[model samples]
Target chain A: MSQDQYFIAVDWGSTRLRAFLCKHSLNANIELVARNNGPGVTKVSDSFEKTLFDCIEPWTTEYGRLPIYLAGQIGSSIGWRETEYLPCPISPEQVASKCLIFEELGHEISILPGLSCLLPNQHYDLMRGEELQVLGWLNQRPENRKGQHLICLPGTHTKWVFVNNGQIIMFKTAMTGELYDILVNHSILIQNKTASFDQAAFDQGAKFTLQSEAGSFVHGLFSVRSKQLFSQITGQQSTSYLSGLLIGSDVRAAINANEWNVDSLDKIALIGAPHLSKSFARVLELEGYKTEICKLTQTTLAGFSSVFRATESSLITTS
Target chain B: MSQDQYFIAVDWGSTRLRAFLCKHSLNANIELVARNNGPGVTKVSDSFEKTLFDCIEPWTTEYGRLPIYLAGQIGSSIGWRETEYLPCPISPEQVASKCLIFEELGHEISILPGLSCLLPNQHYDLMRGEELQVLGWLNQRPENRKGQHLICLPGTHTKWVFVNNGQIIMFKTAMTGELYDILVNHSILIQNKTASFDQAAFDQGAKFTLQSEAGSFVHGLFSVRSKQLFSQITGQQSTSYLSGLLIGSDVRAAINANEWNVDSLDKIALIGAPHLSKSFARVLELEGYKTEICKLTQTTLAGFSSVFRATESSLITTS
Candidate 1:
């Protein structure tokens, strides 16, 4: 096996840290060797290095000092090392160029730069980890690199990226996931906090936003409370309803901000965990767009591997 | 004093309880004799009656078992007594007729019914205490009873009420205040949550929602964090910025749902405490509508007095 075949990708977000032991196989395609998760950036009690090594000690002992690429909030100000946010319109190479490379504890490390864009409305949108998923998605298929694509990465901060010819031109973030978290856990709108997924309730909530007077999000939020009050919807179904409402609002925001007519758009690529990505895909399809769902980890690994290929020799020599 | 002259008006919401001791003066206008505050419906560990009497024992002792009128969350299912919600278009008389009246501890207690409306979009909008503000605002001036009026009651659930010829034609509720509370207290968007108001930051936030694509509220919320990340806004200014963004969205929701042209609307009556009312009034005026701010205590008193006059004899007789 080539020395460059072995590497690791770490996704350290606010709540959890996922590390993938990956290797370029004889076929020259990346394959996962093992996977482990530890505390997130916020949850680490000891140093991040200690927490990371604890999770990957067995792999490191077996493989011997592999190059590691870290993404997400792990590269944020609160993370091990704060990386610069590269501005869009940017390609994977441009993002790789801005990586914060350093040597630590007999390991070569590259902290990926986050992405930022000043939207047309003079609003600044920033994303740390989702850029890797976008890059990976684009790298996964040749067709993805050739055309205009609107990619929706659904998470705590959902990023709607407008891509043209493999570069992210601009993107917007919606606080849909975060809002849902607080509302369900804190607000009076939801009484039954069951994690039960009710498809009909979800669709109904989505339709409520679709039919509501355009951008009546603040207004529609109250229905989560009033609908319960009037027995229009039960407490059991409220969580799903609230989810549908917010996701629908997010979809509407992207379409309205980008001025993308649903009928005219060819396809939207949704990148995230299966549940959230599928939810977004369902709503987008309802709005008259074709959608393809991509697993978050796969795309993220692809993105890191592609970038690793380009920047490997330089990072290794410096370390 | 004439037996009919003395009565008490109470506004009991989820957070606080306020009661006004009032009487009809020689001029036949209602005047407040004294005021007292107590635990809200939610904060009452003891019986609500005990909590009420604890605050107003002095007045009740001096006044000798006067008639009492109650409004707000105190009239909901979780309140002291669950009153029905009267559907719009409803007049104050219609509201009074639906009051839950009974004798309790030798006092004539009448719990007011809340108002509900099926909006044009088929969403059910409901309000408890704010109906009193709408009734009081219209009763305060003869002209208010004669034409179309938009009344905004800003609170945890802000109510946008449309009154036509002395009845509430329709209304909608926005979870702006509640959303603000959660975001400030729980979300990652705000860091420094000083309650200090920054006018410039507020205007910037308000204009952000205004200039962005109509209904881009979900998208705009993330800017509260990203703007800070980019140093476009500071931590201290975040609370005000968030307030402006949510209030601006609330206003936009009303405008879009009602399809009201900013230039065509004559005036919007903002009924709340001075601080919140003024903030809303300033935004409405900026949007080209003249605004009048009404004090909450005064409006609640006026609304109770109006309804009291209609139902006083029946309630007094029953007790």
Candidate 2:
């Protein structure tokens, strides 16, 4: 009987780093062994390797230096090692094939390539960490491989990916979360960033944007300030309203750009942290698009497991 | 003989303070006698009176304690003295009637109240300094006193004013300029804030926004970063492109919000600094709307002159 294989998966972005130790069972099920967090690529002072080691050395001592799969901004030029971006219409297998595998301090590391695409409107779009989540989502069900699907990963740079027959055909990125962060923290619209989320205000903002005649996102944003000034919404409600406006605008634009009828498309899967994914779902559902929220960790782990297993099987056969 | 009475027209905003010593001509013409600049309201450490005296004290010494007409954010709650906002459907004479006139030391100071309006869509919009510009635009000719006209004052908080029969009926404010400032200075979209303006790239960005089906400003903003990553636009071109995108989006949103058909509307009067007014004019003309660019200083002087002359006449009658 074959013993279970072991590996490490790291999701390192601009702000934070998360590493997970996993065991791939004989039945192909992936079990989490341990998880650790560290500073993001930008925050690493001594070296990325030292930071990664600090987080994963404990895992390696318990289980020998297993193979590693790193995803997200960690593969960008500023990350541990610069990796190429895979062009669109790429399957998870194709992404695995393009992985930048290297040896560093007796550990074999594989960094997943980000995805870039020329949108239908001739605009170039890109995504890094979200691709793995898309892969994990696609890996979830056998049927997910054979249909036209839309997956949204909402975060600082929210990604909306289109899949056809197991390949991510094209995708778009909306800077909704980044905009919200900056507008709240940097702009004059909202003075309080930690205000409680008001559902009624958020829904009003989303509905206003969705029902707008020309669907002007910029115009609707100003309403956040105006509504507050008019006493129509309070200081506590302004942040939520702004959030709803941006997400609603994003959904409307994506639908317009892709020419997707909300009622006709398959459910658009949302993959991210629970709060953000639920926010996108709220706006999407408000616009009448069926949505399914997927956890970021689950998707990332599944994606890394699939790639790691594939690479291991290929290595074993060759040896 | 009225002897061409003189007044100091002060446009004090959050960032800068400008004081223009003017002579109200016997024939209702206004001539600039002297002009000075000082730190804005926010920068006043000792007192607004001290700052105002430092900038215009020489002028007052030379011109003999001239009445001071203050406009802009200088009249807001944070300025020297808080002034109420005059409700819309107000004429220049009506704005003058609501002015908060007071005496300090040896000079009379009148703070022009900002304008507030409930838009057709029921959003509250506010403007302080732009009201003087609008009043000046209306005071330019007798014909401006009759019929309907659209006046656009493009600045940090751009105001789209609708005038009917020489009265300020209602207006909307778009945070386009403020958005541009924050994005360039604080956001991740552009790193170099001092990039030169590239007209071609700007036009391209403007055209892209204008032609977009959904007019989504948030979605279009991400294109700035993506286009640069893909080598579609250079860093130098990125700022200009962002500028175009925002201005174009503003124009589009304003048109949409007001339910304006570009071809059917009268020439839109763009009143502000020459460069910003020209930018608005370029986009407005591109959208097939006839535009007239008006100088901010001239408009302010005229606005202040009109309000000052009216107030002086009322004071004379009352005396």
Give me the candidate number with maximum DockQ: 1
DockQ of each two-chain model: 0.80, 0.64
Interface RMSD of each: 1.1, 1.8
Per-residue accuracy of model 2 over A112-151 as CA lDDT, tens digit each: 9998887667877888888888888888889889978888
Q: What are the runs in model 1 whose C-alpha is more than 4 Å off? A: A1-4, A259-263, A313-319, B1-4, B259-263, B313-319
- Give the Cα error of residue B115 in candidate 1, in Å: 1.0
Relative to the true structure, candidate 2 reaches a TM of 0.96
Model 2, docking class: medium
**True contacts preserved, each candidate?**
0.87, 0.64
> Each candidate's TM vs. the true structure?
0.96, 0.96
Model 2, span B95-165: residue lDDT tens: 99889989977899999999888766666778888899888888889998898888998888788898888
